[model samples]
Target: MQLSKKSRYGLRALIDLASAPENQYVSLSNIAERGEIPAQFLEQVFASFRRAGLVKALKGPQGGYQLARNPKYITAAEVLEILEGSYRIADEDVSPESRCYAVSETIQDMLIGPVNQAMETILGKLTLADLQRSYQERATQSEDMYYI
Candidate 1:
């Protein structure tokens, strides 16, 4: 299954949070501006993440959202599921009389299962800290470059 913009943008937002000081609240505007995502969409996406207990929103003078758990404890799969629902490719419902039924089932078992499992394995193992580290490396590499 393809990952939606909500999943991609929201993960970037989370990476911003993961890069911050431990549990420090970060404003939506800041995240949106940095991530180049729409503020309204971010609010909805973050609300879902908050409801899933992946994020926390604070109110008052210094108010915003922060990770509910440490970055290392948060996996990309969790965020993906929270934002994009199940990533698995399900078997289509086919009548037994249909000519493609048997082949379809075999494809689902042999192809979809293995591919989805591989995706799940990577996402489940990749923590937000890992993504943030990747972002940092790219940022560093960009910084090291100079225009002649």
Candidate 2:
């Protein structure tokens, strides 16, 4: 299954927010700039995340957006599902009428099931906080390498 740009950008934005202290808000423009996502596109993505209850938007001078819950409580799968919709791989050959394609159909279904499960396992295990820490490590490593 191919992940769309929307999902990727949304996840990036979430990671930014996750990096912030709890109850802290980060402006959309700030997140967009930091994530390298276009402001216009991030606006739409934020709207979808808000609708999914993954984020809460605040309005005012110091207003912006924040995660609705703890980062560790939010899974990557949940974020992607909100932005990308149902995560289902299609079973192309699964048809009852196609007797000759029964084996292919069975194999397709089997493959889809395991693939879906593996995706779920990875996404479910990964949280926005995980991404935040990952980015932190990368940044630190880069800095360290630069001094070498």
Candidate 3:
């Protein structure tokens, strides 16, 4: 399954927020700058994330957005669901029941079920914190190599 720009940007925004100190508010403009997402698009994505209770918005000066929960507590799957609904590899029309012919529902189920599970498994195991940490590590490594 391919993730859209919305989902990808949402994850980038979350990772940026996650890297910040706890209770720190990150403006959409800041997230957009760091994530390379357009400010307008980031705003739209943030609205959905807020409605999903994945993040909360702060008001007034020094105000912005912050995660409602710790990054470690938030899984990639949750972010994807918030932004992309569900991960669907196959459409409903592909089902044998929909086609009015069945060589093997077993085969279809076997194929679809494993794919769905694999997708969920990887996403569930990955957290926003994990992503941020990886980014930080790569940046650090690049810097270290540059000096060598």
RMSD of each: 1.2, 1.8, 2.4
Candidate 2 clashes between residue pairs 3 or more apart in a chain or in different chains: none
Ten consecutive residues with minimal summed lDDT in candidate 1? 84-93
Better of 1 and 3 by TM-score: 1
lDDT measured at residue 37 in model 1 versus the true structure, 0 to 100:
98
lDDT of 1 by residue, 27-145 (tens): 99999999999999999999999999998999987999999998899999989888877877776788889999999888888998799899989999999999999999999999999
Alpha-carbon lDDT, every model: 0.91, 0.86, 0.86
- Give a tens-digit lDDT track for model 3, residues 1-148: 5789998888888988988898889888889998889999999999999999999999988999999998889999999988888865763354545654463555557787788889889999999889989988988898888442
What is the number of residue pairs that collide in model 3? 0
Model 2: lDDT of residue 120: 85
**How many clashing pairs in candidate 2?**
0
Predicted structure 2: lDDT: 0.86
TM-score of each: 0.94, 0.90, 0.88
Which candidate number has the best TM-score? 1
Write candidate 2's Cα lDDT for 30-115 as tens digits: 99988899999999999998988889989999899999988888998898888878776766755577776878766776887788
Q: Give model 1's TM-score versus the native structure.
A: 0.94
Residue pairs in clash, model 3: none
- Identify the runs in model 1 with alpha carbons over 4 angstroms from their true place: none
Top candidate (lDDT): 1
